[model samples]
Target: MISDKEKPEGTPKILPLCYKVAEHENIIWVCDGAANVGQIGHQIGVLLTNMDKARMCCTTAVAAGSKPHLDIAARSKKNIVIDGCGNRCASKVLENAAVKIGYSIDISKYLQKVPTLDIYQADVKRIAEIVVKEAHL
Candidate 1:
């Protein structure tokens, strides 16, 4: 099952996500998710970042006590937390880390039925769109 030519395995790498506060469009996006949201929050954040609307940061790194990640978030001009549902785990993480959220959106509001942590691709896009619209970002 193993081969010498195969790449070695270890902890997954976390690239440095820090950036100048003003260089970004004044929005720091934290892609956080709960068990009931299965990285959907993260996906939306990525979309927003790809659109050049905001800068995406790691939720896992910050939650796991990465100072660099937390520092970047705390110092952002506007820290935006996108939660996948009503649980608000992402918002809590930012709050506990002493980062204030200038704007936030819960994806559950966009759905008529309660969903598991896993989300649909269409829903992800819709959520990100609404965030951009509602937040005036």
Candidate 2:
């Protein structure tokens, strides 16, 4: 099992980068629960200046109907789906809405190469960076 130690300190306390960027531009962060605890959320949160401007959604198969998820899918431009594993729950959520994914990141593929990296803070950061870089964020 992945150790909780691998996660960044105050993981649940951090935010997502997308949110941070959104805030800087007076936009919002539309995130899915697939990034529940890690650098992905932190990177995204750094972009959030206000809670009302940032939105969090459940990408899980069951929580797909949540308002946050629906709101995100309905309005997001160039949707980005960050999946914690190969299940690709977030991607499916957007696809179901007939929303095309402009970019995607699968953490499971990274973990396979860097087995020692914790899925928490550092791993999340690395993945988020890659996603942002790839997406030109």
TM-scores, all candidates, are: 0.71, 0.51
- Per-residue lDDT tens digits for candidate 1, residues 21-91, read 43355454554544434366677776666565677776667688798777777678677787766767778
CA lDDT, every model vs. true structure: 0.66, 0.47
State in Å the error of residue 134, model 1: 1.6
- lDDT per residue, candidate 2, 38-68, as tens digits? 2344344343222323334344421456654
lDDT of 1: 0.66
| Top-lDDT candidate index | 1
